[model samples]
Target: MHGTALSGWLLVAVCTATGAYCLLRLRSDCARARSSAGGEAVMGFGMAAMAVPAAFAEPPSWLLAGYAGVFAAAALRAGWLARARENGGGHHLHHVIGSLAMVYMALAMSAPGGHTAHEGHPGAAGGVPLVTGALLVYYVGYVLTTGARLLPAAVTPRGGGTLAWRARPELTLACRLSMGIAMLAMLLAL
Candidate 1:
């Protein structure tokens, strides 16, 4: 419990950095950077929220509700994008899962005592950290696998348009990895 706060703050930093990076990249002339801006921002914000006080304190009710609501909408949007075939199969799928995961974490964190890491903690959500554990495992695997892809020589491309960001596999993947790591930190605190 004592060490958890440090990790929690670290996660907060990670998420804040990611968010700032994504938003800043969006300003670049490269449309490739701008394309994923919205998604990355949302991921950053969600992870930041989940990381803070993940193991101990309850988030404000409005914050919990707002976080869940926004993510729920993102989930729905992901579902729609998937249906409309607007995004890549893997990326869109991640969005769908990530959005749902956010909602789950929000509600789980907002539970009686906001102690989801240890399901047995006071006000535990179902007294089972099954979802949290599953998300943790998923993020770990994703981060490892994605890191492997980064081992190859990579080049940032230039493009201008809404879809340009899709061309920058490195940035997009890095955003995903950072977000996954942030979520992992939060889950660990739970």
Candidate 2:
């Protein structure tokens, strides 16, 4: 990522932790929950790997291509999931967007004159400006909307007894919100 080393490390930590939590959600009794968590875990870990600071170790082009390939497949799977009648599909739609965004970033970074070519150029990152701008807008809106949804849940009391963190809808919302924020940050860096 095009940022201070500390910020890069912070992104890594947040993404890694989020991925771990998603893995825990795999234990959920709900089949849909397990499926969603598995996809989310992939996203979280992928973001963590991509967020590694350029200053520390610039990833090879082949690795970036691998990322693009992985995310492309993920996008396809998410799209299929979104079309399934039994699934709520709304969240899967978001996963589709997120996976495509990851593919975009990976491809952009792997381009010949990508991130490396723009060193020391303020506000000048690799990738098509229009595409990056659109992603930025999408992630920004996603973060805002998700945060709004989480607000009421934060203040409201629930009648049910305690549930596992993995089963708590509010925590899931919060996790999604955090990932949206992280995506926004990453788009900015791009």
User: How far is each candidate from the true structure, as Cα RMSD in Å?
Assistant: 4.6, 2.2
How much lDDT does candidate 1 score? 0.68
* Candidate 1: regions farther than 4 A off: 1-3, 27-35, 54-58, 116-127, 154-168
Report the number of backbone clashes for model 1.
4
Best by TM-score: 2
- Per-candidate total of colliding backbone pairs: 4, 0
The C-alpha TM-scores of every prediction are: 0.76, 0.91
lDDT of each: 0.68, 0.86
Give me the overall lDDT of model 2.
0.86
Question: What's the lDDT for residue 31 in model 1?
Answer: 46
Query: Across residues 1-190, which tens digit of lDDT does each residue of candidate 2 receive?
Result: 6778898899999999988899989999889999899889999999999999989999999999999999999999999999985885988999999999999899877776567555666434558888988989888889999999898875433574678777877877777887888888788777
Q: Which segments of candidate 2 are over 4 A away from where they belong?
A: 119-124, 154-159
